[model samples]
Target: MHPMLNIAIRAVRQAGNIMTKYYEKMDSIESKQKGYHEFMTYVEKETRYQMIAIILKSYPQHTIITTDNNTMHTGDQHVQWIINALDGSINYIKRLPHFSISIAIRIKGRSEIAVVYDPIRNELFRAWRGHGTQLNGYRLRGGMVRDLEKAILSTNCSFKMNPNASPYIKIIEKIFTQCADFRRHGSVALDLAYIASGRIDGYLAINLAPCDFAAGELLIREAGGLVTDLTGSHDYFYNGNFVSGNVRIVKALLAHIRVK
Candidate 1:
């Protein structure tokens, strides 16, 4: 195992433990706003402190880009750890079991390694840039469902973001009408991890951050899936909008999204 993978492994496990504690003690939890979401608490802050300590202690010079604390990074470090200390904060706050601790380390901004763990489920999903995706320790690869109509799809919807006032709803509504199934799980990392394990056929998300999809990108690709922005561009980390699946459905989904 790469040394950095060990670091990611430790950080996510520790974060998960901290989350479980908070998950069990909801009455004492506090809430704050981050972006349009009205939720955040001590667990998010404390776990980040712990993760940063672990990652920085191992590689003191490594920069971090994270959603928990919004610490901006600058300079030419070869390693960057993109972290979402609590990916499903709202679900976590509600005592739902879908939350996860997500970590993905980018080498010069291209995430080559990732770990997404859900302590409640004892699920640890990982992927190296070239190595195949893994669950616990088993290697994983995706299935080829050539036709989109037969494929199961997953996404995080934004009726609020669109508020019946945007054009994106039509795309997902069409997907709902055609696919074998469609699920709306609040956790982006887990949703992508499921795609890697062949538990789901494909996924797309609007406005995914670097941390949200970093670890997931590797898992999807390593699992014999391809990833690209809706425009078919390899600029997902910047564009923050992308699709992933067996090669057959990838383009069709992109076409459905009408990405250039």
Candidate 2:
């Protein structure tokens, strides 16, 4: 294992332990609204602080980016550690055990390592740049379903009225017609990890931050899958809209999406 990846795994696992300790006492945890339909709790802050501490201790000179502040690049720019301490905060607050801790290491602006750990399930999904993705130390591969009718897709949906809601719903309806089913999981990190593990055939989401899917993106790609923007391009990192799956599933999905 790479030294940096080892440190990341240590940090994420420590953070996951913190979250698991708090998961059992949801009623006592207080949460505040961070944005429209977004919530934050002390668990996130504590876990973030713990993970950062562990990481900076190992590499004090490396740049660290979190969801709270992604643009502040002060430390060594050559290596960046992007972290989402609690990927599904809303679900955590609601006692839904489907959340994860996502950590991605980008060297020279290219993702080199990724780790997504689910504490409740005790499943660790990790990947190196050239190595394939793994779940609990076993190699993972994306689903082989090439046809949409045989695929089960995952996505994140917002109930609040927003400009993109109508268009997003329309796209979902169109895909629903062809796909076997859709699952609206609150965690994009887990969704992408699922794609890598073959739990879901594909995933699509709009308006997400890099912290949300950075780790999972690398996982999918390393696991013999593809990740691209809604337009079937490699601009998802900038556009914040991505569709990920095996090559055939992703191409089929792009064919159904009407990108305007």
Candidate 3:
């Protein structure tokens, strides 16, 4: 693993420990949205505080982008840490063991590293620009499921409010009619990691943000999974939409959509 990627993995594991320490505690839960509850507990806050402090201390000049609503940076530097300190907040609040701490670094608007830690499972997924994806230091790759009729897929319902969601759904609805099964776990970070680990055959989403996908994109590619815009372009980062899977199946899924 790259030295920077090693640091990223450490940070993600540390954040996972912090978050897990507070998991399933009734006192820390709070409502955040119509369909969401949050644990913005001291654990989440302090973990991010520590992670960001560590990043700034080590890479003082690099700008940090996060989901905390606490920091923002313009497009000035060549490096940025895009993070969702606590993803699957609703699941976390419900004590469902599905949340994660997602951290990815984008250099010049392109993802170069990403680390996501599944606290409940103690599974750590990490990838660097040229290195293959890894799970606990072992190399990984997407699964070999050629037919959508035999593939397991995932998507996010939260994306429905976006402009592309309808069309994206139109494509996915077809998958439901043809694929083996589909699921929505509410965490894009984990979904991408699952693709890299071969836990899911393919994944699609609309309105995914840079912080939401940058790391996962590189990881999926490194893991030998195919990723592209729904329209078959490789420019998924800017397009805000992507469909990824085992190489052969990804090609088939991409054939189902036309988006730019």
Better of 1 and 3 by lDDT: 1
Candidate 2 residue-wise lDDT, 130-169, digit = tens = 9889998999987888888999999887646677598888
* Prediction RMSDs, each to the true structure: 3.4, 2.9, 3.5
Error of 2 at 195 (Å): 0.2
Ten residues in sequence with the least summed lDDT for candidate 1: 29-38
Best by lDDT: 2
Write model 3 residue lDDT over 1-260, tens digit each, in one string. Answer: 56667667777777877777767444533423322333455556777877776776677777888773335544447888887777887777677778788788878767788898888999888888787889888989778788888999998755455664676667777767878989899788899999998899999887677777777878898898888887788777776788888877877777666423
lDDT of 3: 0.77
Q: Where's the lowest-lDDT run of ten residues in candidate 3?
A: 29-38
User: Global CA lDDT of candidate 2, please?
Assistant: 0.87
Kindly list the per-residue Cα lDDT of model 1 for residues 1-260, writing each as its tens digit: 98999999999998888878766656543433332234346678888888888887788777888883355454346777889888887787677789888888878657788899988998999988877789999999787688988988888774565464255677777667767888777899998888888778888777778878888888888889988987888988887886888898887787777742
**In candidate 2, which residue pairs clash?**
none
Give the higher-lDDT candidate: 2 or 3: 2
Give the distance in Å from residue 30's predicted Cα in candidate 3 to where it truly belongs: 9.8
State the lDDT at 98 in candidate 3: 84
**Number of the top-ranking candidate, with TM-score as the measure:** 2
Model 1: number of clashes?
0
